[model samples]
Target chain A: MIRFVLACLVACGMLGSVSVCHYMLTRSPVTEPPTSIQPTLRSESALQTPHRTPDQQADTTVSPSRIQLQNNDAARRFFLILTSGFNTAPDPFALGSDGLTEPTRLSAQYGDKSIITLLNDLLRGESIRSSEFDVADTDITRGTLTLFIRATPAETDARIPCPLRIDLIRADGFPCDTYTLWTPGNGVMLTGEATLNPVPGSNTAALGWELVK
Target chain B: MIFRNIYWIFWLHLLLNSMIPCSSARAEPLFTVVASTTQIADLAREIAGDRCRVISILGPGINPHGYMPVPNDGKTVASADLCLQNGLHLEGKNWMATLVRDNGNRPIITCSDGIIPLHLDYDGTVVDDPHAWFDPRNAAIYVNNILKGLIVMDPEGASQYTARASLYLNQLRVLDAWITEQFHQIPPEKRILVTSHDAFNYFAARFGLTVRSPVGWSTGAEIGGGMTPERRRHVVASIREGQVPAVFVETTVNPKIIEQIAQEAGVRIGGHLYSDAMGPAGSAGERYIGMMRENTLTIVEALSR
Candidate 1:
């Protein structure tokens, strides 16, 4: 009976010690500042600079150092061209032969300097290639963008129900210079009313315009 | 009977005492973590500090754009109790969509969801720009969102998370102030930014900088082939005129064109800018903070004097 009492007392003692230790470990005390390190904007500055720099006394514009302009030339007008096209349907030919008339077409006209952005309104997994149109009379300024597509002409022999999607690009062809997956945009319309036409019976279509100043 | 009861009580006491240390050791985390990359897999480590593991999937130098899914990525995503991502389509809508589609249980938090995005005026097609993290102010929003998510995920460590987040947020504010101060070194006119793509709109708008690009907002577009001869001449002229002191290249995009532009216009290619992706690890541009700091330093050095 004495031993039982002793055990109870020890157990309670252990619990009390643990509680006290936990309290000590977790306790955060707030203390009054001794006035020397008290936070104030003026006090901070006084601590930083016993002798204030003359520049801080009065707001004066420091003479800005000018860089020697090397090969200084006037700003020129740059034109950026944007084309809208997509392959909504699969190509008819699986052999993947390059044709003249591509599945889509892009054309642009701008005067001097212009910056244009072509938005590919396709989901991430979707794919599009550049060879879908003949980039006639156009030269790519930046080599960053490269596209490939096989061109096929519209057939005159029979009245096809839907325009066949020509194999604009081979399976191994580089479709876009930079693949922008998940890029979204509405259908391409120039001048607020014109919409690019889809290949007559095929799901693919083309829209072209020039962004120039 | 009393002796038997006393023996049972002693064993129980011993068992409870033995568990006390283990429970106390795990009572709270020892540190607070903030990661810039979404690819980190150590979510538990970040919020839980030393107490748990934290991982990020996209870290320094990883391109969330055009990032292909790997088998390990799936495991990381599955193992994480909470995941944070830069939404606003910055993760290449495909990446974010796929992650959400795959993880049914975990919340794929969008850090940039609440912040207003800069709209890209693509000839009147006003769309919310996804590159909000480019600006430090916007990045503050992202950090706050991460803090909220971390606290919610690990409510037990709420105090730790809050404290860490506040500390980190103060650092971010310092970074912002530093960037502004460093920018003052450059003359106002020299603040014009010409990059390979239009990825710096938010940064430009926030910092009173003018941005021009060979390409538009999305780097995935065909920007080069669309330039007309007159437009080419204009860019050539911009180089000759010295309106733009330096042109920057993007990490994921090719720099050849910008280099060529530099050659034509006689301006130097300022430096490589982290756009769709970050710099390789160990480089100054590796982490989010490092990347921003390096960019500011590079900009100040190149444009200032």
Candidate 2:
């Protein structure tokens, strides 16, 4: 009887040990919380939190400096080509002997410098290798200009040294001509209706254009 | 004794069974995303929620136009399952896009797609304006594109992404309406916006304002280097002719040229506007909506006089 009782006790102890072991092994393994459950890398509010700059605390007033201009020969040549028909005050809407309309004189004053520089760069045969914005022709007689402006790269933060192309077509001119100026490297093209207005008290004509949606 | 042996064997068998590990309850892997800028990253995160991990290559206060991808950025791109960019050459030569493309052939979502781009008339070329996010309506398109990309990458989270995106879209619509209301306070004639760069064209187009700046549409236009006599003279003349009440500087650009122009034109600096990039984290212009609001408020405060 003692032997049987001892055996039963031993069996019960063994069963208890086995049950605990089974629970431990079959139970899900302890894991660190999923990365998703961890605090987000950046919260909207956290992003909104200002990273203060030294200039932020300063007064709004800033000292002025002398305006200086760099004479880019390429820019000068491109401007000359762009404004070739400007001196003549030709009717921008009238078709020339050629198939295209007469080259309308545009105000050089309204030209963006970045566009000037980029045209200069491209016309000087600067190969942007990636996008073919090479100057095809500067033929003014035809009143038709063909340019291979490089396409803006699709990156959000890339500031390549290119120009944003802005094309202006006269709203009222018959067979309206399109003139383009672009910001350097930003692919923003601003297309508008360009009308030439005779500058008061001056022989030259100014571009009368407004942005179109 | 035989019964005892049987009991021992049974106990051993139970122990062996217990040692076998269960193969259930594995957590789903988190989708990894790499965005070119903070704005895109924020959009991805808002849409992705817990379903994805979004990282931005350009952090707070960094100018995307001048951003060069470091090697670590390449590593981040390598680990990403999807990439998002603003597209339209907003990345200043598409360096970020090129980096991602070089890293792998993963699907890249250009958020600027499907939005009617505002163009700048440069000579005779019409270039697409990269700053479409200036208008909240365009931002809605961005959210939609991001949502579509997320759904395509992780179809399992489609319902969640759709729900989150819908909520975000609602918020954007509210923002757009609020912007319209704010702009209404300023008189049409007084709605002239003079800034350091021509970044506010979209904002101007959306809210009926005129934008004049010494610099062209981009801050990368050779800050001091590109400042020609003609450009400087034109900007100053525009300010004087338009009677522009005030000129504003930009957060990402050097305000020196604009300050000079303002001083030369005898106009006070209205306020600094966030252009090209959003303000630093914790700034009034930190989020896209907040940035637009701050800009509108600054414009109204200066121009509404």
Candidate 3:
């Protein structure tokens, strides 16, 4: 009888202790749980400091549109940009400094790593560059051309009365014989459109864009 | 008698503690997933994301065309909480089905369920090619099915699986776009892909290229797949006519036939490509993405000349 009573008491104590321990363990809050992927949320300063490369600094600011240019030719080419509607001296709601208010700096997520920056005359802000970036060529035999506008979420002007014309001409100036790129009046702020054209006899195709309001 | 009862109680404590929810409870039934091939296994692992254990029957470079299952394979299949198979006759003699049916009939998820299969001539009979994963877009389908499978097996992990699947799907999308750009570098006439078997049909169709192979879809006889004299001669003529710069060999299939064809056509053997199986572990082609990337680079390097 004595042994039976002791055994029952011990069993009861064991069960109660286990239940409490389990409850505490499961109830405790985990400060940092184990996970395979931890999303890194870094600040702009960490990536866009002046010490960083020109590409890194340029990427911190948002922009209107970005175009990727690649060529197989030995000679380097430059983009010939024609402009009219930035409206430097327009009515109120005129763009800041450049008649382009709500300025932005955009970049493409994929493509070649080395970026081609705009010339000195096109840039204004020390870090936030101009919308008129350059389209330079390389000797590398990259066969595709890419154009990415800040489309999808919201449409900005470039934001008010955006630049009317931006064309990529191989020659020094607007050579009518050469094909060119276009910018619409709605501005480069929404849905992205891409088309591929086969270059006759050669592997490269000159990028052409259509102008729309 | 009293001391003996205390000893018994001590063991009971340890036993009950073991039953608590913790990592050491592995002896208990787990969310275990089984795959028939390494490619599907890799996809399952990516989608599972540490939530479950994934086991693959076929190791690196093991041909699924003529697999002979061992006794241990039965045990592995029996223990699975879920089974993943690359359906459409990817397994030889439908062995995976037999193993699962005999073992326990665990819920099987067909990874190729949603893909629009490409039909090819296997021993002169048109059959659905089981190499759809060669295209990253098709791989996204595999990922979705696995995502659904994992969620069904462990509903608690649905959010984690969905997040992982979303990220992985994005990676696959990027991979597809990257492949398109890579193929664009080659001229229209030069965009010919030569492999050991008819494994590149989906890859070629997705990226706007032409595939030339001397061997049938598989290298096994039971599957009605083998190189024929007429096919070899035709392939040689095609290579010569196009002045094809290079041909490729597969990691899983025998390289002898491809070597002979290369010699006859006087074209250099373009570096090896991973077809039926990925490269051995620790190699660049070990994972699915790495395998695709390596194959693309090999073709680009060899044919661009």
Could you give the C-alpha RMSD of every candidate to the true structure, in order shown?
27.9, 26.5, 17.3
Task: State how far residue B209 of model 1 sits from its true place (Å).
Answer: 1.3
Tell me the tens digit of each residue's lDDT in model 2 across B55-140: 88887767787677889988898899999999888887798779888897667889888778888765456678888888766777
What value does the lDDT take at residue A58 in candidate 1?
22
TM-score of candidate 3 against the unseen true structure: 0.58
Among incorrect, acceptable, medium and high, the docking class of model 2 is incorrect
lDDT of 1 by residue, B1-305 (tens): 86887778776876776566568665554333323254222223333455445655665546565466666666776766666666665665456557646855466667666666777666556667777777765665565566666667668777886666555544554566567667767889888787776678887886667776765556553212334456557677765665677888777677887788778888888888877666665676655677778777777777775
Q: Higher lDDT: candidate 2 or 3?
A: 3
Q: Report interface Cα RMSD per prediction.
A: 19.8, 19.3, 16.3
What value does the lDDT take at residue A162 in candidate 3? 41
Best by lDDT: 3
Q: Give the TM-scores of the predictions, in the order they appear.
A: 0.50, 0.54, 0.58
Minimal lDDT window, size 10, model 1 chain B: B38-47
**C-alpha lDDT of residue A73 in model 3:** 36
Between prediction 2 and prediction 3, the one with superior TM-score is 3
Please say which candidate is ahead in lDDT: 1 or 2.
Answer: 2
Ranking by lDDT: 3, 2, 1
Model 2 steric clash total: 54
Docking class of 1: incorrect
Model 3, span B96-156: residue lDDT tens: 9889998999899888886789998665698889998997767877887788778888999
Task: Give the DockQ-based CAPRI class for model 3.
Answer: incorrect
